[model samples]
Target: MAFFTKEQAKAAARRSENMLDQVAGLESYSDERFDVFLSHSMLDQDLVVGVAMLLKEQGYSVYIDWVEDEELDREHVDKETAERLRQRMRNCSSLIYIATDRSGQSKWMPWELGYFDGYKDGGVAILPLVDTVNSGFDGQEYLGLYPLVNQVNQRLYVEDASKVHSDFWAFVNDPSR
Candidate 1:
């Protein structure tokens, strides 16, 4: 097998960098403690995993579905689990939504958005990462579909995943200003 050409290697490196950029606090903020809620479609697992890892490194509690096996079966999603996630979303100082694909009719993403919608006034911040340009022929598009938060709408998008992490952190760190 031939090694990747220089251009191929550079492309790979750029992709890696883009993955890291999807979330903001990957550098280990051992001193700052914050709760982060991650909402996204399963189609965007790549970006979600990156954000989760970065937030975990930053000493932030991250509530990510599917990662850590927190995802509940559609039929088994009891009230308790819903409440737990809801509470996390409502109380988390920072809410990061990896909206890389359409969550229009997703299993739980819309609900997560609803939770954030209710607590927008509590200073709960909302950050979105649009990692993908399109989610294959699902016949659904997610470029501009934003989760509507109460009076305040806070969402950001990036075609590159590497940059999303830093932007997310910046939003979480300075949500008010």
Candidate 2:
């Protein structure tokens, strides 16, 4: 549950804002099946919901498993449920793994990430939502070679809400970076 220093958060926010400005023109090109599939631990529902809402507000199609379907029993995911989850992953252009403390321990998050990587041939962007407002993240190494949205040195992670819009759109439009 360690948090970023105020100064570090501010710097990250500024970087986010700059990135947004640079990628402002990319909105027109980002028309994918699903803009993002938000993968997170069930324990961090509220935070993930907020992030999904923000993305949706920016006109990005976000797929959050529990929110999109009421039939999913979080406590008991059966074979059918697993297949449905894989289907959703296939439909997404990007996967945003909410890299929080709880997510690190979740059995499904890593599996989903692996599935996406294999299905998309590493073409789809796999971004980590680090430095979240509520939860702390394990070190960047925990992401295990995946590109991250909120790493300390990376240009994508931003604390400012408005900046996130630009950063995300930019990432989706050009996942190769």
Candidate 3:
């Protein structure tokens, strides 16, 4: 019943510094089934990588653009990049929006959320990483429409406050969910 916070994410980053040993790059969209297409700000590269590793430890295949597609050039905005992301999103069962102070600045996060929301019919959750559990994602827009992802003993869960809270694993495992 604990919220996922920035401190925990940072710890994960420290827990394992290198991802090359963990996830194999060049993950084929057609060959792989990803549990979450991590929608995040490229500015927070380390944080996102940590989150991906954390999720992988929980037995989920995560699709991170730069990780999977190393050829992806974030600096160069192109229609193909969007299309590639679209294809990855299609292969994922859910999308986790890594909400932080830098999250609002990402051009792809909103589009990823919107596309996944429409494509998966609301298969998106915001993993709001704040400085403290008591703090929240303030001034961020359009994030409340979906559930929130949190951690408990390193396990992931999704919950819509005042509604329902369930395991992140269960959500991905359940087809009707």
Candidate 4:
């Protein structure tokens, strides 16, 4: 499957900002249950916004920390912040770890992935971003263990080494999972 390139994602992000009320993270508040709990490095804010836009366009509701939790500070971690994040994670049906060049440096992405995988079971996937469209993911070692999110013809799918690309929803809700 073709992956999203950084340039394409940025363009999509700009379009999302101009077409909607705002960019993915700056959009109006959402109090409803989220389809995805997006886990990514704050350093990839622009990329995250773009990725969220793609998800939103595909009819998925995404939960972004900066957009939903303005009170929490990443630099100064506290019990309240962790607790609040956990609570939010519970409200989301699935988690999408956006694996970028900076993902390995993040402190929360791995924890969020593990937490969602354990508590929700089969509700976790990785969306890898590359410098070019045909390029592949080269993130942390363990990231390959989970299904990798992919986009083809603007539709999302998840694939692992042992299986072909599966429907995004079906992959997350697989009964065998």
Per residue, candidate 4 scores C-alpha lDDT tens digits across 8-60 of 77987887775334433453334456888999999998898888888888788
Off by over 4 Å in 1: 1-34, 56-60, 68-71, 122-170, 173-177
Writing each residue's lDDT as its tens digit, candidate 1 over 129-151 gives: 33232212121333224321211
Better of 2 and 3 by TM-score: 3
Better of 1 and 2 by TM-score: 2
| Residue ranges of candidate 3 with Cα displaced over 4 Å | none
TM-score for each candidate, following the candidate numbering: 0.49, 0.63, 0.90, 0.88
TM-score of 1: 0.49
Model 4 CA deviation exceeding 4 Å by range: 18-31, 172-177
In Å, residue 26's CA in model 2 sits off its true spot by 29
lDDT top scorer: 4
Q: List the residue pairs that clash in candidate 4.
A: none
lDDT of 2: 0.59
Worst 10 residues of 3 by lDDT: 20-29
Number of the top-ranking candidate, with TM-score as the measure? 3
lDDT of the candidates, in the order given: 0.46, 0.59, 0.79, 0.80
The lDDT ranking, best first, is 4, 3, 2, 1
Sorted by TM-score, highest first, which candidate order results? 3, 4, 2, 1
- In TM-score terms, candidate 2 sits at 0.63
- Per residue, candidate 2 scores C-alpha lDDT tens digits across 1-177 of 223333343444444444333433332222326778888888876556555544554577777776555557878889988888888777787787766556767889888878887887543433434454455544446365554454333234432223332354666655562
Worst lDDT run of 10 residues, candidate 1, spans 148-157
Q: Is candidate 1 or candidate 3 better by lDDT?
A: 3
